[model samples]
Target: MTDLLIRPAHHHDHDAIWSILEPILRAGEAYALPRDWDRERALAYWFAPAHHVFVAEDAGAVRGSYTIRANQLGPGDHVANGAYATHSEARGRGIARAMGLHSFETARSLGFAAMQFNLVVATNSHAVALWTSLGLREIGRLPGVFRHPRYGPVDALVMHRSL
Candidate 1:
């Protein structure tokens, strides 16, 4: 990855962003999203105005992407929420960790007091471990909250951390 940079995503980056998002969405392994979600809907959901979307570029190509925004409205808004997706080819290269740390800093700068991942599928141990390593604690768990394409219904863990 030459000159990898994290920056606000532009309209033209949608294709690359979608390319990264589709596999994640289709897998329905780590996220709570529906596996049957179409590209158009996923695009709108990710690029909505209420969230801040970013892309990690290397050598002028998109390698990873993340979306950050308030977890809730009004009082709950002090806690931020984020979702990340990396190109399959870019895995195990520190892209996710770098994006996670970057999102933490970006959230704090926006005045958020903490960050919360509302629904991290328990079956995704790698993500659970990563979030834990990032200092997010598993505050709660929702049983049978996520429908994994292969694993059927699975528990979702709520991970939170003060920024």
Candidate 2:
């Protein structure tokens, strides 16, 4: 098993985070983010100072990353929101799982009573199963919520778990 270390992201880790996120975005799978989004915009959207983001580093290189924040403002702020991406080469090594667990812990520590994934793409069965295995439930589905480049329009699942 890989010895992964999860930690807050520093300014230097932006490129490493991009290395994992760019392909996932370009592939237009899983996430609802725009396919043609550029690196600069993606960096600003995912790694900006307003959000709490982390990187998973193994053997001195970043192989994955995740971002967590309040799901909404005011009354809904008690719920947490998160997103994760791992390098394709790192698949099946439990990198995403580790990041997910780490994010859960961080969210709880930050006083969020629950965590919610607002838009999990239905075509990405791997992620759906992973979230299920982690005890999150599919509470709702938004039909044709994501426009996948290869699969065309697909449903998006909204998942939630109590912290």
Candidate 3:
């Protein structure tokens, strides 16, 4: 982690970003994105104008990526909504945690007072544990809301934490 660098993403970082995102998304265990989405559709969603995207670079390679944005509009804009993804081969190396901690600082600096994940698929244990350890608490649970590819219908957590 000594060489890990968390920085704002640039246009040139698209391929690296997608490399980390495609597999996880296709696996359909965590995020709700479509499995058959092409690179262009995926990249477009990641680079949406409202999303503030960042990448975790280590040894000159992008190991992971995250996004921070308003959880909602108007009265709800003060709370941050974020997402993170680590490259398939880079799992268990603490990339997600590093990006998560960095997101706290980044979110607070951006004037967000809190962060909330509306749907943390309960089956993604690594993400659930990581988010919990990072101070997010499961404020609510939607039973059988996420149709996990392998697990059928499963619960989802609504996690929140003050920034």
Q: How accurate locally is residue 81 in candidate 2, as Cα lDDT from 0 to 100?
A: 95
Displacement of residue 149 (Cα, Å) in model 1 is: 1.6
Q: Return the clash pairs for model 1, or none.
A: none
TM-scores for all candidates?
0.95, 0.97, 0.98
Q: How far is candidate 2 from the true structure (C-alpha RMSD, Å)?
A: 0.9
On lDDT, the leading prediction is 3
Predicted structure 2: lDDT: 0.91
CA lDDT, every model vs. true structure: 0.91, 0.91, 0.94
Residues 26-137 of candidate 2 have per-residue lDDT tens digits of 8988777887798899999997665899999888889999999999999999999999999999889999999999999999999999999999999999999999999999
Candidate 3 lDDT? 0.94
Candidate numbers sorted by TM-score from highest down: 3, 2, 1
Instruction: Assess the local accuracy of residue 96 in candidate 3 as a C-alpha lDDT between 0 and 100.
Output: 93
Preferred candidate (lDDT higher): 1 or 3 = 3
Worst 10 residues of 2 by lDDT: 1-10
Best by TM-score: 3
Model 2 ranges off by over 4 Å: none
